[model samples]
Target: MYTIGQVAKFLGVSRDTLKYYEEKELVKPKYDDENGYRKYNPYDIHDVITTNFYRELDIEIKKIQEIKQSKSVTDLEHVLAEQEAKILEELAYKKRLLKKIKSVKEDYYKIKEHLGEFTITEMKPLEVKGEITEYAAYEEYETIRNSTENLKKAVTLTSARRVIHFDEEGMKEERFIVVRKIEDADKNFKGEVLSHPKCIYTVIEDGRFVNGEKSIDHEVGERLLKIAQDNGYELTGMAYINILLTTYEEGLERVFLEMYAPIK
Candidate 1:
């Protein structure tokens, strides 16, 4: 027989841990009335060693108790199989999360490289699901939210607005719409398609706010027109804006956007 301290030292565990095991009925140490202390026999020490072995595998205390009291090999096998399946499921989720993180990092780097730079490029066709407007009701907002939630790939949250008409004064009417790349769209989808074969693309950083809402800088639109004329490209009067990201600093908000206007 050994004292609690002796067993704890030999097993490399605390005396309190041995006491806790005793409380859990994992190890029943013999109490010595004359000495006023607990005494651990070889059997009690063996039980503690087995408990530590299960703990090394990260088995929960309650589950370890179940394993200790298991009557058959099949019962033990079932519990272990459940744990294996849970681990595999968690691994899959972690893999997907890692992939998303890597993709977002790549996008951030790309934005930094092309920020505020203008170029002539062709964009793939997009399917407009619905319009996003300042005056939209809560029910309309919920409908759009539910629709995009089912998509497997990331959806473009904003396409800014389409220029309905342009005149000497300025744009006559503008309609804001939500769009996604055509490839990711579902079959039987009935919506307008926006395709720009050749367009002036540039990223704009806006920090203006009005009535607690972000407002785009119209000066950028004037600049786009000027640049297009200098390059001898005629404007098609259609503008498509894809918001890249938003950041806040020093109680101010900054919005980065990918702006495109069709050229003829």
Candidate 2:
């Protein structure tokens, strides 16, 4: 027989935890009234070790107590197997989250590198030839690209292409593209492109827009607009972004926008 403190020292558990196990009937120890101290026998030591093993496997305290009372090996094995499966599933989830976090960090560093190198300039509107179309809500570049591909198949001019995005009524209402000729504009382009008068635009330094990181475009554009306003430039006309490529294959390119302003 060993006192509670002696048992705790041997098992490396606190006396309070052993007391809790006793209250839960997982480990019943003898008590001595003379000292008002609890005493643990050899059988109690074995129970404590088994309870700790179950706890290490993350078995719930209630389940552990039930298992101990039943003394069923098959039931204990089932609980342990469930705990192992849960641990593996959680590990897989953590791995995926870590991968995403790494990818995001890499993108952030890349954008930071480009920020210091890019230049912003006010640009005069120029004629762009491409098919024009209306854009619906949440329409993305990939959808626009598919539309452009279909337009190319229908048109004879291989070189003419440009997409213009415009906002209307608090919604993304219109998309316009300039192709080689009017004869090439058709339903296949997915929307009608009416001639938009040339407006002032801003030009971003070449190699500013990165592929697989288009979200940076919005950040850059917003920052440029703030800079323009700070310089007392009145933003008046539609903004057009012109992407000039140095290496499309490597996603190294410059994007500049032409923002129109009323002559003050």
Candidate 3:
């Protein structure tokens, strides 16, 4: 028979840990009443080793207790299966997170490379919905905040400027809007889809905020229009502004946006 100290040393665990296992009734060593001491036989040592094995696998103490008391192999198999399923789900989530990290890093590099540079390019197809005229409570806002899938597919907050309208005079209208990517597979989707064949694309920085609310600087709009006129591109009275990145510096929110002004 071995003492608690000898068992703990052999198992690479602390005596308190062995005492905790005793308290949990996971391993009950024989007690020497005359000597006022505990004694662990080889059988008790084997139990401690098995308990450590289950712990290394991250099995909870309660679950390990259940496993110890289980009479059939089926019961043990069921617990193992549950742990396996949970691990697989976590692994899949981490893989998706890694993919998103790589994509966002690439976008940051693109923003740095193309800031303030203008080029005529085709805009990606967009699906437009309701307009956000002012700051107030709305159903779409709540849905996007609460639903994970909808939030993931919400383009307006991540990559797209809600909406921008330009007429012959200049930028006529600008406001936030509820918008998402057009799903080709969804037959039920009936939102208006827009496509621009040619557009003057450029990235602009805006950091102006009014009354703690986000607002776009109109000067950027004038500059874009002037660039189009100077380059001899006929205006199409509309433009699409997409967001590339947003950052906070010195308590100020700065937005980096990509604009696509349609040209004839």
lDDT of every predicted structure (CA atoms): 0.71, 0.53, 0.72
lDDT of 3 by residue, 52-111 (tens): 988887889999999999899999999889888978977787785776567568768867
**Model 1 lDDT tens row, 20-120:** 88888888889999987998889999999999987776667898788888888898788778778878976776775776567557657757876877888
Rank by TM-score (best first): 3, 1, 2
Better of 2 and 3 by TM-score: 3
Relative to the true structure, candidate 1 reaches a TM of 0.63
On a 0 to 100 scale, what is the lDDT of residue 169 in model 1? 54
**Candidate 3 local lDDT, residue 184:** 64
Candidate 2 TM-score over all chains jointly: 0.47
Higher-ranked by TM-score: 1 or 3: 3
Candidate 3 regions exceeding 4 Å error are 1-23, 27-58, 126-139, 145-156, 168-170, 174-194, 208-214
Candidates 1 and 2 compared: the better one by TM-score is 1
Q: Stretches of candidate 2 above 4 Å error?
A: 118-264
**Best by the TM-score measure:** 3
Which residue pairs collide, candidate 1? none
Q: Tell me the number of clashing residue pairs for each predicted model.
A: 0, 26, 0
User: What's each prediction's TM-score?
Assistant: 0.63, 0.47, 0.70
